[model samples]
Target: MSIWWSLHLRRDAASVPLARRLLLGTMETAGVDPDVSYDLSVALSEACANAVEHGGDTPDGPSEAYRVTAYLDGEKCRIEVTDSGPGFPATRDRPSIRPARTDAEHGRGLCLIQELADHVHIGNKPGRGGAVVSFDKILKWREDAPLMAV
Candidate 1:
């Protein structure tokens, strides 16, 4: 069986943990391995944090909300976080992951997401204005997993 969920969340710091908890709960209930769940949860938090911090028309004027979607099917789990911000720069339609400076406290979220997930896609929301960060990872099931695919 496959499980999926989506949330329209406020672009606030508190919303980040809510999304992570939901993902972790879904993974645990579906019998995903603990390590896999941890990776996904961390990645989700980073994506959500980015949506809260940089997801806005102006740097100081952040968007009011963002969306987070998750899907667990067969042997993989996919998660996407989108925000109604100005979106990535036009020159780089698909922004490349760049390492954060050693002294920087921020800018590490995107890189962390890339490290955790098997595949990631970062781009803008076509006609509408927003940023989209989606990622997926191959799941590992526990020995006695109830929802493991046959």
Candidate 2:
């Protein structure tokens, strides 16, 4: 069985948890292992939080909203978070995961997401002008758990 979902959310802090909770519920229903689900949830939170923080308008006016998409196919789950902000510096200028400074209280979101997900891809959204953070993990389910009815 395959399951997929997408959310178009405003660039607001509250929207972060909304996305996390929905992803958790979906993973739970699909019988995903708790540890795996937790990892994915944390990664999802980081991605969504980044979108909420950096995926917003320029000085002129508010930009378009952000989007999150999740797809579970066979034993793999993939998630993507795309924002409508100006996007990170040019691809060549950005590092895969920049280490946060010792005294810094922020700038760890991308690094955390990379650590949690089995595979991660980050870049700007094509033509639209924004950033995209995508990740995938091979899922493992509880042995005794049954798949949810579609």
Candidate 3:
């Protein structure tokens, strides 16, 4: 069975939980294991929060939006979050994920997403003016769950 969904949301704080709840509901309906679903939800939340906080045009310009897409196929799931802010720093400018200093209050979203997802890809949107963070995970279903429809 395969299912997919996409959301175009304003780059606002409220949109974060909206995306998370929808993902959670979809995973639950598909009988994904609770632990897997929880991990994915946390990763999704981090991605969305990043978009809301950093993925936008200049503050004086028009409000911008972000995109979230999720695909569920059999025992695998993939999710992508795209934001309209300045794309991620150039490849050479990105630093490896590391534990933030104890006094730091930020810089952990990407690291958290990386830890939670099995595979992650971050880069600019091809030919577009935004950044994209994509990830996938192998899903585990409940033993008694019914087969999901494609």
State which candidate has the highest lDDT: 1
lDDT of 3 by residue, 25-130 (tens): 9988888888999999999999999899888774356447999999998778999999877777776754356667778899888889999999988888666557
Provide TM-scores for the models: 0.95, 0.92, 0.90
**Number of clashing pairs per prediction, in order:** 0, 0, 0
Model 2 TM-score, 2 decimals: 0.92
Q: Which wins on lDDT, candidate 1 or candidate 2? A: 1
Q: Higher-TM-score candidate among 1 and 3? A: 1
lDDT of 2 by residue, 1-150 (tens): 789999999888899899999999998988999999999999999999988888888555776578999998888889999988888888565546887998999999988988989999888867867888999998898875577333
Off by over 4 Å in 1: 58-62
Q: 138, model 2: CA deviation in Å? A: 1.0
* Cα-based lDDT at residue 16, candidate 1: 95
lDDT of each: 0.92, 0.87, 0.86
